[model samples]
Target: MLFVGGITLLKNFERLMEAFARVHERQAIPLVVVGFNRWRFENDLAFAKSHRASAHILFPSFVADEAMPQVYRMASCLFFPSIYEGFGIPVPEAFATGCPVVTTNRGCTSEVAGGAAHLVDPFDVEDMAQGLELVLSDQAYCQELIARGRARPPTSASTAAPVNPWIYSSKYFTKLPNRRGPRASLAAPWGISREPLRQCQTYQGTNYMLPPGGVMVDSPDRGRYI
Candidate 1:
């Protein structure tokens, strides 16, 4: 199994570790946790040790972007049960790399999964353990998820164009700072200039925004662009 996120409260790493311990009790599965934050590393490590799961969990700390695909391909499934996210990039990344996903039933994760993943309640440890077991034991179901994931990206990409103008407008208005503000130093790196940015029709009740030149896409409250 694999998990990708920093050791942050919002990422819900502790709950995942507890759930993994339950799964490990039944089967000696090695879980690769592929990100870390300094603030929580010691506490997370202590929790793992307390659960007797330290030996089974690997904290890789950081993995290079170019090597992420290989990491995803090696895992049986990607576990991403974040409490909240602006958008969940790892879901689609796992999808594109043909890794089955077991993510949260709520928030942007369920939307990104597009019914192609094994959804579990993030707060329910038993449910999460069951999700992990099902994905690991059911070969047919795993393949089905893989097939659906492979089919998801293209359809999502084709529908993302309508949101580009929204992205441009939102980023210009919200992310860019005035010429003399404290964040003025960020302008050059982000390619911001004095030129007037175009405004696009706002898609009401949506939180979608695409970075300049980013290719990943999604729908309103149902998909994401990364």
Candidate 2:
């Protein structure tokens, strides 16, 4: 199964949905999407339903924190082709869980993916579809990506450099609290320490401490998420 976690317009749900539609057109792989609800849910669903691929997409919006690691373990790969990202937590979360990642090259996602992900164009459905195909069709390549992800632990030195610019410029994190020592280990239920999620910051100014990150909401006007 393929997984795409989080919510946002920048996350390119429509593009992902359409790309999955194309993937389904060629093969019958199911997509498991986990996140909060979106305003375009009905429209995205309608589009996928029209393509007759709705049944192949699963949306379990609220997976308890206790059960999230199991969700990642079940996934064949994690697809997060966002047009913009402050720093994608899910990419590393999947990486930590030994799941191959497929994300966009744009924005902070590239920085956090740390050359361990299958970078794709979030704007191009065909490109995203091709990424999906490559991951699902090439077991050796997929395993290689997973192995690389494992080698580069979330907060390890391997992932510290090449930080995304948004890591400091994000409007959501404008009021970030100061930190002295290394951040506390923020692990999910299954010993998966979520480090990249530290970069997420919502505009509403909600506190996003600890693992698993915060609930993301996209602003239609700015096309940014928090």
Candidate 3:
């Protein structure tokens, strides 16, 4: 079974369904389009009926999130050919569940997949056909992707959050100053290379780096120190 989502203009709904229709003509696959918005649903239904391709088009808009796992499990792969995205979270979520993903190469989708998913041009029907064929025809390749996805590390949020100042200092500031200041020996308590100072120079009570002279003194705080 194949899962489809949404019918918005920017969602590439028409291109996706058209690709599926072409693929199905060659080999029939059960497709269920999960939809929202009653008017768009009705319009899609009419389009499907008029095209005489209603057999494979099933609309199940009421499925709950908890049951989405069963839908993912039932399918061999998830097909998404969106033209653009800010960050494609669902691609990784599907990967976490052991479902192989076939999505477009644009936007953050490619970056998120990290070679775990097959990428194709969303605007090219032929490329989409080839991608679907590759996955559905080759069981070994599909399993390789699934296993690779399983080995992928979980996302970390600290990447975006403000981290402790000490961590940044310890990791990067460990390097010695290129040129020492006049009183580098005394005022710079992190002495030449001796006992580490709990705190470095401060500009107006704020932590700052020592000047080129590497001198630490009671001089008035300057804005450049920061």
Candidate 4:
């Protein structure tokens, strides 16, 4: 089975659908897409219909985090041809779960793949299709990617503590005063609300604080806070 994880506009679901259609025409491989967004969901549904791939593609939106490892393990390869990403958490997540990846040749996704993925041009539907076909048909190549992925460093915050101890340390997350009262002044130097900081504190049940005036963005893919 072919798998595409984390659907979003920037995730380039359109190109993936088109490519999957091409591959399906020749092989009839099933494509499972996991994730959800109202606008993206509707648009992707239309795109799949237009490509004549709606019947072969499965959209099981919003898979729980606890079950994601099983999804990855079941997948022959995780197609993540995102046009943009802060860190592309799914690449590492897939790696950790023994799933080979097919991701964009550029940007953070490639970096996250770290030579373990089948790199494809996200803008080129044919390239994406060929990459998918190669991974699905070539068992040796697929095993090579799985071996490389298994050798990659741990990506989750909890497992990365040995590599970066500060990630789990108390100093990494600064406690900010409440924003609704006089204590809000204490957070004035950072010029950000307590809610954002609180989000960092609780992200993945780990503590992470940004520097003064630093911006904290929660990646839409699996709440990968950075």
Query: Which model scores highest in lDDT?
Result: 1
Model 2: per-residue Cα lDDT over 1-226, one tens digit each: 6555444677787788888888888887788877765666666656656655788888765787557667787888888888886556777777767888999989988888888999998888899999989998999999999999887645432222223231222322334455332323222322133433333322233333334433332321232223
In terms of TM-score, the best-performing candidate is 4
Alpha-carbon lDDT, every model: 0.70, 0.67, 0.61, 0.69
Ranking by lDDT: 1, 4, 2, 3
Tens digits of per-residue lDDT for model 3, 17-121: 777777777767766776566437667667766664567777775876566666776777888777886555456556657888888898777777788888999
Q: List the residue pairs that clash in candidate 3.
A: 180-213, 181-213, 181-214, 181-215
How many residue-pair clashes does candidate 1 contain? Answer: 2
**How well does candidate 3 match the true structure, expressed as C-alpha RMSD?**
14.3
lDDT per residue (tens digit) for residues 1-226 in model 1: 9988777777888889888889989988899988856577778767766766888888774687768889999998999988887567678778878999999988888887889999999899999999999999899999999999987753322123232222112222343333332211111112221111111113332233344443323333343223
Across 41-100, the per-residue lDDT of candidate 4 in tens digits comes to: 776666766667788877775677667778889988888888887666677778877899
Candidate 3's TM-score reads 0.63
Counted clashes in each candidate structure: 2, 0, 4, 0
Compared with the true structure, model 2 gives a TM-score of: 0.66
